[model samples]
Target: MSTPLTVVCWNFENNGKGRPDLRAAGADLLRRLAPDIALRQELWDADAHGHKIFNEQTRALGLQGVLGAESCTAVFYNPAKFSVVRGWAQGRGPHFVLPPTALTLRYEDAGPDSLPFNAVSYHLNYASAEQRLLEAEWLTTWADKGWTTPGRSHHTLPAILAGDNNSYPTSSPGDLPLPDLNTVKNEPHRLHRSYAGPSGARLPDTRPDTAFRTAGLKDAALYWATAPHGDPSALSRTVNASHTHGPDSRVDRAYLTPELLAALTGFEVIEVDEALSDHHILRLTLNGDLLSDVLAPSMSA
Candidate 1:
């Protein structure tokens, strides 16, 4: 009997900025979704109010939340379903202001079939494409089995990395054109989303997402919807047009290691209520068979 595990990732736009009263609406929406795990970005002051709001909302939804760097990024899981074995934030300080919260979790009620799985909730740097690329490279280390922490602990587990990547994939969906940088009045976005082209023209920089694919991870959305040429309607854009001031594009994403990819059962982008968050939610579902098959010792005959 395989259990379906749902994972959702979202950038709650500074955890519902400018609408403090509506802050809990995001968690309320998440409660309706009933995700087993959630990866969040731009959760401004998640530890604020004496961790009152954050704790209350998450607990009400049966989620155990762990604050990441600057309390901006976080990972939440159902305590009854899983327990965090090892969790920490990576790429802090000069590298990324909101580092990815990485964790290895073990199934709670499983005996020997219990296997560790890795997950990361990341909000990549928004001011520099080069910096974001470096962050992507750092994430690939998990799939590469080269990840090590300051404590000298290492992990080589089937992993899921998700959140606001802050950039588009190397190839936009269906060869669809990205938003024109010339129209983007946001100076930081104009500078970060593109690099100089011929004669100093602006061109979209896709190296960040390319880095993850070049490694061993598969983007869950792309793998489920379409590999090379994706169906744009199916892989809907995540950004809110009003918020961007320019043509909005899909920026939120989720990636999985090979074994986990095989376990993916469903993937979707939920158009969240704008009152709750500006960015749509990216949801991925995988079967629990992954727990036992994640680390296959040898190739099948």
Candidate 2:
């Protein structure tokens, strides 16, 4: 049996003006959560400030951070528990906007025989729903082609993709009920662009949820639906109440492969007391024994 592993997904809203003391407070919030792995988005990497904040947060949490580029998106892991075997990025173009990041990670104590699994940190395009949908389709296709394993189809491993998806699941109980216009108008453009449109235009189908399902990826939050400890009320609360970007909208999400889903033990959306970021944090826990299963063949060989 393996111990439980904790993973967190958060978007720091690291851009904009008058956002006071965010770096320190964000680091502090992460430190408090102490996740084994963290997927972060909306990090402003155009300058040194973003890098500085990433570094500071990693130091405060005692985790090792990797940014595929200056800002885009980032992944951080506890060095004592895991190490990155390889890291890379995927995006729309050579200079893609907020490209997705991937890391192949192996458990530190699994010895030289350990097998690595892929962890992706993604932040879909925020300006246009059509663009975000395209990004999601590209991501699903990438997974279908075994991009994680590069040229080796048989070597493809299980993966977990988490970050600020910027769109809701199509299968969600109901449409993400929009917040009051007054509240949304003052918020960032990225938050409402997917759901809100011209006065008479119908809302676009912003379902990264459907795309992920079609790709054979499973929602971590849905794992609760079948577990013995699962609570429908709590699950509904977590899904409906869990808004990552704005207080009333849920844009952040995590998805896992069926293999990884088998190891899921717990999941929740953690509410932060302070205004560290406009988004809340998502937490996922899994059985560490899953790592052993993935590496068992190599160990025996």
Candidate 3:
């Protein structure tokens, strides 16, 4: 059996005016949360200062940190719990504003042949729902291919794609309705053409929820909604909690492959000081034992 692994996915917001204080507050939150792995978005500066700040933060938490190109995204892991086997940034494409950072890690004490899983930290386009949908499709397609890729030295393992998805899980009744284009005076800036249905009819929901589900990924928070634990009432309250960005909607998320979905043990959207970030931090815990399962003989060989 393997130990439980706690992961946190957060959009730190761009490092700009008042960044010092925000970074400090974010670091403090990380210390308090103490996740085994942290998948971060919008670190925003690839310069020396960004590297220095990220390094310091991870060091303070006693974790190993890897920052992606242009400081777009990052991944920090507790070295005592897992060792990075391979790390790379996804290929840049038109739909992606920032390519995701991918890492494959093996438990520190596991045998050399033990299976290792992949974790991808991503940030989809926030300005356009159309762009966000296209990006989500690309991401899910990439994940499916990666998970099914052939002939690896080690066994195949599950994948966890987490970060600022900037969308909802589904068009559920509880979800905030998308404003009608005409109601908003056909404002060019506010209208999301991608959300329009056949013949340009406004969609009731604008989130890219279905696109992801069709790609074989499951929403972690949604999974917890049906299988409540701890305070049952809190499950609904926590899952529906809004305004990770300004006071309107919950956008940050973590999506897992079917294999990893079965191992999900806990999920939560944590609220923190707005000064720290406009977005809330998302936490997900999984049973590491399930992740250690190897692929069938044909694939493993």
Candidate 4:
């Protein structure tokens, strides 16, 4: 049997200066997609600019906050369909204890391969390439944490690292390398990069296919074109003059392990000619039994 799971990754601007009706847009997207899991970044605290707007929007959508950091990255889900057993935050400075960088949880019918899966949302450093690389390294560390030995108990179980890694796939902008498909295919949580050719160039065609291995397992680089608002009558004025001839610009991504990928039902990137924010939402469908744990008591029918 297949289960339908929808996951959305988006960097909703914390300061609500871009769009006046930002909350409405978010609610509309959520309502239209109705995803089972949502990985969000750039979320400000209640004191922040758009926090109230976002809260109201999500509150209206009937989604319950399952896990989050002090108020940065967070995960939300449809409570009626799934339950959040536990969660934590990560990414506090060295001087202070880091927040739970990831949100860990289990669901009622999450599926046959019931391991604790992690859902992470983050905002890599925007201004510094060094910071971006540092964040990437941090993610690698995070992804490699429990995979050391199969039998050892992990602080957080097997996880699906999903978010906006501001760092480009290639450390620098204009080089291409043939990636190991074996690395990306048929493995549980194989580290995969969406862009392969260059750091600043649009996403390369060599990125993993949306469909790989099993009918349920798959991955892909979703991209699109967008530019600032321009002249009223000149169509030419609206197009981005620089990098206009490059492949799709891939700024958002998702990495599902073989086990989780096998649960994928379907996926798509919501194509927007123009986005309310600088980024677009990466949405996909996961079909299978919800993930639960061996330690938990069976739910009574």
> CA shift at 159, candidate 3, in angstroms?
0.8
Q: In what order do the candidates fall by TM-score, top score first?
A: 1, 3, 2, 4
Q: Candidate 1 clash total? A: 0
Between candidates 2 and 3, name the one with more favorable TM-score: 3
* Candidate 1 similarity to native, TM-score: 0.86
Which clashing pairs does model 1 show?
none
lDDT of 2 by residue, 163-216 (tens): 777666554553245443344343455344555456845353456777888889
Please count the clashing residue pairs in each candidate, in the order shown. 0, 1, 0, 27
- Model 3 spans with C-alpha error above 4 angstroms: 16-18, 90-94, 145-156, 173-189, 192-194, 204-207, 228-247, 293-301
lDDT of each: 0.74, 0.66, 0.66, 0.47
> Candidate 4's error at 6, in angstroms?
0.6
Off by over 4 Å in 2: 15-20, 45-50, 90-96, 109-111, 141-153, 173-201, 233-247, 294-301
The lDDT of model 4 is: 0.47
Top candidate, metric lDDT = 1
Better of 3 and 4 by lDDT: 3
